[model samples]
Target: MSKANRTLKKIKHQGGRIVPHLILITYMVIALFPILLILINSFKNRASIFNSPFSLPNAETFSLVGFETVFGRADFERYFLNSSIVTLASLLFTLLIGAAAAYALTEYKFKGSTFLSIYMAIGIMIPIRLGTVGILQLMVRFGLVNQLLSLILVYVAMNLPMTIFILSNFFQQVPVELKSAARLDGASEYQIFGLVIPLVRPALGAIGIFTMIPIWNDLWFPLILAPGTKTATITLGVQQFLGQFVSDWNAVLASLTMAMVPILILYLFFSKQMVRSITAGAIK
Candidate 1:
């Protein structure tokens, strides 16, 4: 009887675990099904796309016409280059400046430091898009309306508040003794920062991924600020292409796939770092 009871309990425990796994698997499928459909249809002919949209590509249905159309119809390569430049430049500026500001707020004592921190933190509650009109007017005043530089600056400003907040939290967790010891060893503040940065690198990796995605996927600023210029980013270009190729199903799917693949690859690469940092934090 005890043996049977033990077996029943083990079964119940396993069943409980399996239920959550099943739920997670279901969510994963739901999330991925649309992307899978797009990728599957991207390689299919227009007839196949409409006729068997849910089916996988076969020998008779496989086509590269969509990709060819996208290339021929859009300056897709330039759009990608513009996006890459803006995302990378903005990411660099946000991390470097935000990290320094965070470290300063966490480390130094100054008049109005607390108020200044609060002032910066307020940007988190406010969406930068809310100031689009003012930003556009400011850009026009400086003749930066259609420039990639303007896009980069806007992204940097948009991402800075959150970056500083996250990095400041991490900086606070750094051992004051380490900084004190370094200072005792005649290390200047810059030297201490250099030492601390590598220790917080995993957190930095997490922030980089967080900051890059929004900037990469953003359509509003790019559309409003850099429309019609060669500085148009991939998201804006894809939107324009979709509008132009409304009936061209294959071209639309191909352009989407092109735009998605890079960001997907980047996310997958950094996701590990993000997960690791979170896990490490929990452990600590």
Candidate 2:
């Protein structure tokens, strides 16, 4: 509490910020700088791009050729929508089924509970791509190939493990007394899920994110299961666009920049919820 001691402590804290700030600033540059480069270059002419790839857009260099070509060649807005629909539907189905299964695993004690839980965990480490040949044939048998529904179904199955793992851990942290009391008050299991699940929504927000990123970013399943130009997700569409216009620097950069926009917007919007939800029940 002495004045000299307080001054020393403040100095130490001030010095501590330097390393962390340096690290943060370094990483931010590494992450954002490239995207910024692509975005600015997208607005620049072919000659200006080589002249100053990193320079700010100005009257001398700015152009919209990339944007023009991208818009002209493909239905980017539709591709964006396809990504959204598949991501959203897969997220919904994964969380619903995963949460329900997690609740059952955590809330009920039974003979094969441990075995069943272990069985579900097996999917986590396994890459479903290994089964592509069989999956393709099976889809053909069901006439589901080339459909967005096929992609949605595969994504749900793919993301189920982590979702169940997350929700189950959170469910276990919900006090046993709460569930018993809800039951005594005549709440059915479905009623309990309806009433109680909302309380865990911050956790769900975290789990929803964990499920969403892969589905949204995925290229393999979309390539294999639903490669139709009509139903292509943004990732695949952008890939196809880039391949077709490989020589068009402006269009290529534009497509990359366009693809980055929705994800960046989403991360900015839900970031706090995502972090909090993941760490919500850690101490308990």
Candidate 3:
């Protein structure tokens, strides 16, 4: 109403905005600083790494020796391929199986459905690593102890509980009428699932992004279950490389930078969908 009041309100609103922006910038710096430091040092020589670690790579300090050393010592291509296979396979089975389990539990009234849901959900609370001894023994018995398939199976099992929990909530929000209408028109359960699965692509994508990270970054299972050079994921490969080349600063930093870049690119591409779907799923 008055100029003074309007000015005061504008100042208050601007002040409110400043606090959040400052907090966000602080968090961004906290998160990205290590990655930036790694990238910068990855380009510099060992002497520069210690003396000018904060400075950007310059003509005098810049080098690719680390990358060269990395390529020389490790079969990164094989490691990448192994990681890609395990991650993608685990993602595919986890989503499909989790979706089906979620659908059955939420849409059906069969006996023990509640108990089964609780049983599956128990995995979410318990870390899968706790059962590593039993898992390793079982895999050995099945002759899958040192194979990529073991990693895929273990990752899928580890991720499935959270996947089912997220999807079951989203499935509950899908109108019952949609399924009824499809059934009335002669669609079978399989067809209904086929149609419904696509409809929840956003939510699935969100969960996929969430599920894929830990699997990709996991070093424990890969180290224990599939530590062979041919079976090592990128994370395990990097760790092993670092162990042998601990004195090689450039290679160590380069290896870390390489490992971080792919995931960063992936998150940037899918982040919008992931955030939107997560919010929508939560609201539903």
lDDT of 2 by residue, 197-263 (tens): 8867877777788778888889998999899988999999998989999988888988888888879
Q: After superposition, how far is residue 249 of candidate 2 from its true place, in Å?
A: 1.1
> Per-residue CA lDDT of candidate 3, range 136-155, in tens?
99999999978999999999
For 167-279, candidate 1 gives per-residue lDDT tens digits of: 89899889999999999999999999999999878778888877888888999999999997488899999998899899888998999898888888877877877787678
Stretches of candidate 2 exceeding 4 Å from the true structure: 1-20, 281-284
- CA lDDT scores, all candidates in order: 0.91, 0.87, 0.91
Candidate 2 lDDT trough over 10 residues, lowest sum: 275-284
Native-structure RMSD, model 1: 2.2
**Please, what is the TM-score per model?**
0.91, 0.89, 0.91
**Candidate 3: clashing pairs of residues:** none
Candidate 1's C-alpha runs over 4 A off are: 2-17, 278-284
Model 1 TM-score relative to the real fold: 0.91
Tell me the deviation in Å of residue 219 in model 1: 0.6
